[model samples]
Target chain A: MLYLALGRGAWGELLAKVKVAAIQARPVGGDFRHPGNIRHALELLDECFRMDDEVQVACFPEYFPWSGGDELARKAEDLGMYVIAGLAEEEGGALYNSCVLIGPDGAILGRQRKLNLGLMERKHFGFSPGRELHVFDTDFGRVGIGVCVDFWGPPNVGRELARMGADLIFNPSFFFIFREVWHCLLLARAVELMVPIVAVDVAEFPFRLGDKVFESCGGLSCIIGPPWRDLDDFASWWYEPKFNWILGQLGYEEGILIRELDLDLARELRGAWFSRLLGREAPWP
Target chain B: MLYLALGRGAWGELLAKVKVAAIQARPVGGDFRHPGNIRHALELLDECFRMDDEVQVACFPEYFPWSGGDELARKAEDLGMYVIAGLAEEEGGALYNSCVLIGPDGAILGRQRKLNLGLMERKHFGFSPGRELHVFDTDFGRVGIGVCVDFWGPPNVGRELARMGADLIFNPSFFFIFREVWHCLLLARAVELMVPIVAVDVAEFPFRLGDKVFESCGGLSCIIGPPWRDLDDFASWWYEPKFNWILGQLGYEEGILIRELDLDLARELRGAWFSRLLGREAPWP
Candidate 1:
């Protein structure tokens, strides 16, 4: 059929089912250099690995244990799982909010700089914005990271990532606003990109920049997938969008949220509709 | 100050408050040539005008009257309201799904052809797709129309329209699938485009193409607005996206659903955030 002809890659084997964990870590008194905070975040990662040995990927929200790149790299190697977490990177006397992805082999895979800097980040913190976007190949599939407002505000960042064949997108956010707005925006991105989004947010914390204290109402970290996957069942074609398709989520609390994603199913569902609708050789724009 | 600087047009006045009606119409039998169907649809339009003397714009679902161009122009002139409705156009032996906009002065303002054609539309019906997109300036503001699948599948059609400064989008659909899925897709479009979407769908009807009988599960006609408008209140910043921003909606029934849309507010909200985040003078991509 047209779907099979225009679909990406070969049907092959559906062997890319992956379990992911969102480590909703809390900040330690606005101090990324705090040894105790780094240690506590490491303990959460280790606990997550112990809780689910099958977990292949683990993520943390923005700037929690912010300066623990070496520790996370070591932990990923020790646990044999890919680790993605936010960082407050300082280079040449400039600060930029970033997310680092470490391979299971203990090597730093890559880092995605936050492209869209928030108002406070620019005016108060004097943060610099990133210029480019990237997608990395992993054992499970291709992955992309969108830090905080980078993915939420501009649809282009996430759209470009998905167009580059990102099977999954990991969003590290320190959203200080309402959680529902974030949820709605994230859900919309997931549906539009046709990619599963694993977004982890920091627990509610008081962020201090200068004399301004902004309390982040975080902990709506969640995983969202395509709703069209249900179309496989003939009856599901009549299903309503009344209910959200968020696979797993955490409320306003500090915890670890895990969910299993079927990358094969996502690809199939996305390919079938996009190919049929787009009628182009490429599955996407 | 930055928002006012980069926002579209002068914010000297916020005078545009448009009363719009979505005529959730039902097809009469299976023929567009049926006089009864055209008469019924026109009567509904008249009732809508009588009900709200201030109603500025009125819309109908795709292909309800199928081929009533002259009558709608006359009705728009008589009622002094802009009319947007779908049609089945036949040109040079090629058929296209189109939506026409009739001005209050009985002038054919413009027509937008469906850029994306569905599988059934292409194969069974031999319908051709349109090449260009346009935005029509009306009494209230700039308006764009996305016919059925045109606005749902691809993000560009709506994005391009929004980028071109469409304050309000009128989507005429004969969605035959599940209503919930349609709702979710349209909601995503409204949020992403930052434009108010008035989507009117036909009631449940059995569409017969040759011997194949396809039932359209329609009647999810609705008006959706941006959630960011609520940010005017400082407390609203904490409000969740839990409650839908759909101003008005109709269930699986034939009726006239009307709602007041503040185009001025939509532009201000979209510009404020887009300019702040995008940091560009255009306020859009």
Candidate 2:
């Protein structure tokens, strides 16, 4: 009764399930401003769409689109699917690293600009950090997005999204090093927030920048859910005869990782693990 | 100059190097209020002391000594080593899960009470939570301690300790279930705060609670440090010749995990990674 009251009644019908896909793309080489790079990115998007016809929402890696938001929106509209793609937007001579969520209606539902800037982004690219964080309401559920480094900083962007009633958080990252750190951080964010996370990372990309060569994105994209184990013994946890919670995971390769999230299970676990601790009316509610 | 200035001035001599140990002990069964359990805990402490004589600071698992705070303090003075051990304290008709740092001078330097309570703790034990967080300054460095569940919460207790100028955070955890979450959270807290962490977990202990028998603490104690790799290529971040930052780690077994931490390296990396982003004057400073 408490779960139903706190978990937005009509939990079964209103939030049935969502099939999501994370497209781990290989990094683009040559001039990033080149039109050919944009074409290559679109080709990857087409591949992702073809990989799974039932994927209601598809996510791409950070800075995948070179330009042309209108074309991307039109493509999302044609496919009748929600698409979250990361790109760099130049406005009034200032560039902001941003993630745009395009609705099935071909309109931009929301945009989350990267709040934290990496060393290279600040000194080399002159990119200005974003000031606001936003969560978008979609057909499946409320969702939030955070670009690569934004998820890495203190006052974690994912936690803020979880606080904003996001059932799922999408992290589009371009982490080129410390693959172990990326995996660990993703798990930390998921467990800490008690929310499902779909994190898409870039594949191994070797590129020369001036005199230095950069490689290794280690595309280990994954879909993580809340606590799935129940205590069978007072000391040990037992997870069996239940759902195989880890939907899908990929490692250091360009692939479309798709999984159907059990929204009901997420809500149930959140209630059992987090909500009950804080009393009936949870902070996220 | 910026690193030295932001890093509290003393570059080398004062905060040179520290050898630390995390002792993962099996929990004492029967009555938690038993005196024999306290003697058993002292035996484990003796084993840890015998394991590494060079270890300046050693940490024990949560709720090691069933009682006797003065005995633990006297042992630390006898060994001439700083010791952090977890125990439960009864004060003013209320029970609190606490971790006390015993100075080598046979004095109780400080005690950190567990801020968060687990489900079983709240329901079965009637444990009252602590309100304040404290960091202790030892001869080696500024140290902070968190008992079990306190380290698992968001706006991490370890991060708060780091903000309080704690160079090394000792997380004495009794995580019996979800071993993967424990490992990931420790790594996440370490990397996010850019501070070294020595997390001592309990070994597998099977005990009967009512009708069911639960087993597992899964020892896996580890000493993790700041970023170990220096980029061979600024853009690629490829490590050619680098020191492995994780000094030592133990599997799910009763053992002493010892590692020498280079304070200078931690301060340097903190400066390189975190300090430059927020200008020169860090909030921690």
Return the top candidate by DockQ: 2
TM-score: model 1 vs. ground truth: 0.84
lDDT of 2 by residue, A136-222 (tens): 877677788877766754535776787777888888877655665676677666656767888887776664555665565457888
lDDT of 2 by residue, B64-166 (tens): 6646788888888888878887778889999888888888777998888877776656665677788889987766667778677567556457667777878
**Tens-digit per-residue lDDT, B68-156, candidate 1:** 78998998999988888777788888888889898888899899988877666688667798889999877677888988877875667
Model 1 ranges off by over 4 Å = A1-15, A29-35, A123-125, A204-216, A226-245, A277-284, B1-15, B29-35, B123-126, B204-216, B226-244, B277-284
Model 2 misplacement above 4 A: A1-16, A27-32, A153-155, A227-245, A275-285, B1-16, B28-34, B227-244, B275-285
Give Cα distance to truth, residue B146, candidate 1, Å: 1.8
- Cα misplacement distance, residue B26 of candidate 2 (Å): 2.8
Count of residue pairs whose backbone atoms collide, per candidate: 1, 2
What's the lDDT for candidate 1?
Answer: 0.75
Candidate lDDT values, in order: 0.75, 0.69
Candidate 2 chain B: worst-modelled 10 consecutive residues by lDDT: B1-10
